[model samples]
Target: MSVTASQVHGAVQTLTQSSDTLFLLLGAIMVFLMHAGFAFLEVGTVRHKNQVNALVKILADFGISALAYFFIGYWVAYGANFFADAQTLSQGNGYELVKFFFLLTFAAAIPAIVSGGIAERARFYPVLIATFFTVGLVYPVFEGMIWNGNFGLQAWFESQFGYGFHDFAGSVVVHGVGGWIALVAVLFLGMRKGRIRAGKHTNFAPSNIPFLALGAWILCVGWFGFNVMSAQTLNGISGLVAMNSLMAMVGGIVAALIAGKNDPGFIHNGPLAGLVAVCAGSDLMHPIGALITGAIAGALFVYLFTYLQNRTKIDDVLGVWPLHGVCGAWGGVAAGIFGQTALGGLGGVSITVQLLGTITGIAVALIGALIVYGIIDKMSGLRLSEEDEFNGADLAIHKISSTSED
Candidate 1:
């Protein structure tokens, strides 16, 4: 039977929609797996006595984040909701639903990043409560202002600087916000017991390097989907984004290897720092620019992580502030510097706008974190009791350890 032109066009449109939906679904799944990476990375870094707590926190936070974002965060950011009937929500091959799934992964990452810095010392329920407020309210405000262009912030940037702040995949929106909030939490919790005494610091080696390596690998692999699939449509996907991400990851690894002096922990975390830096400009940066950005991020992470541990009282367990907060801010600014046409980038970016936007994100994060964590600390408390911390969260909270005599 000869098909009518209208019918043929309809079929083609259906095919396109289905393809985009499938693409996004795969991306969402890949990003979802990153939670496992977060879990294992924390598991390996914290003391063996706290392994179970690390795993549990990531999982519980994932659940809490899902509900918070699904119910409140998504609406606040986009002014949309899933309150419609399933049939209505599933139109266009459920593209909106999968989009939520994809973006939800990013939202969930806020708590996951915070989890790393506050690991081993935070109380489970209190941290979970903080996660709900953060994911549901604090994060969405900045996210809306940047990505959704809400509140005319982007328009103001464009009016003054000739371009809105350009963060292709949320370097500041997600990573910077998460990292800075974590810094507040770390500060509120204070140093872990005996972490520092009389200005002398105690070094605690990772409990398991293999697990740490595994977690890093998972995040690395998942990051392609994080960056590439961020296009959110088949036609929008670019090989350039993938290439930039690759070069940045390699640069971070190589730089961290040199800067960190072959420390296994630094080596594993280096690539994450690079990826975080590149996320803002992966689409616009020349691969060479990406490499330099990643290298800077890697060196920055190694140096700052060491500085915070040894020379300061801030006991950030996994260096989220350096890897995510600092590098993420740099990514936002680097996009403007490296994304200029003169520098072999796609251009249409302003360094001034980038700096202002990044500073705004940091301000929101710091203020939100202060209020949320401060209130939670005052109301119900944030840290575990001294005895529980001394005994370790695994035994004290979970009533079990990672391994038992069988």
Candidate 2:
């Protein structure tokens, strides 16, 4: 028997579809594990008395995010849903379903980012409510605007500025939006009780250095899957994306080592800062441009985190504002600069487009978060009572500590 050309083509298509589905499923799994990293990072950063709350909150936020995104966010962003019968939905190797799974991990990250900023002082249920609103509504709106070209915004940008915004892996769409919203929540909740005295902030050392490092390591490793698998198909994978991610991470580590003066916490978080900044341009930038972008982000994080902690009343626990918000915005702009051919890039970006898109993302996040968090604050209260805060969230909310003497 002879093989037909049409049969060969169909077989190839099937193989590609299966491979892509498996690829995305693995990516979703890797990103899911980053939530564990978020938990441990919070556990290591917050005071020992609040460690359990940190862990519990991240896990709970993830759960809320999953429900919200699966039911609401996916549809809001892409105008698609899982309302059909299972057999119908399972076509194309169920690629759309796995794609939803992958993006849900990103949507879920909004709450995880906020979790770090509002740790120890926030009421559990209120934050969960905020998570649902953000993941289901606020996040997907902006996500659709950029990634899905919703609302004709991307078309307008391309027509006006010669290019639309290009965020390869969601520096602005995910990290920036999450980070800025976290800023709102952190400011809304205020500083942890007794963290400030006589107009100066008291520094709280991390509870566990090893755990912090471990968490950073997990995020760093998982980020490859996060950035690379963002292509969504085998045919779109690029070695340049992988290389740029590597260079940017190393640049961030080195810059943080110098700027942070060997602080272990800063050291671990450096790669994350770099990775966050590089995400927008990872597919377009030269390794050198990525390095520069990452280096700047690393230094920026150290300075801003220090300033926010000491010189300002903004008590963003774990510095989510700097790490994700500022760096993510920088990533958006950097993609415009570093993605130009003059800067050793692939050349199809415009700085004006990037800035406009970045600003839009920030505006959406800030306005949406202000409304959601404000309503939640007024209706149900956002923070623990001083007594509960003083007792520590682990004991106050969870009725236990991280550990007990047996």
What C-alpha lDDT values do all the predictions have?
Answer: 0.95, 0.94
lDDT of 2 by residue, 365-395 (tens): 9999999999999999999999999899988
In model 1, the runs with Cα more than 4 Å from the true position are 197-199
lDDT of 1 by residue, 31-130 (tens): 9999999999999999999999999999999999999999999999999999999999999999999999999999999999999999888999999999
Task: Evaluate residue 342 in candidate 1 and report its C-alpha lDDT on the 0 to 100 scale.
Answer: 98
Residue pairs whose backbone atoms clash in candidate 2: none
RMSD (Å) of each candidate, 1 decimal: 0.8, 0.8
If scored against the real structure, what TM-score would every candidate get?
0.99, 0.99
> lDDT of candidate 2 vs native?
0.94
| The 10-residue segment with the lowest total lDDT in model 1 | 194-203
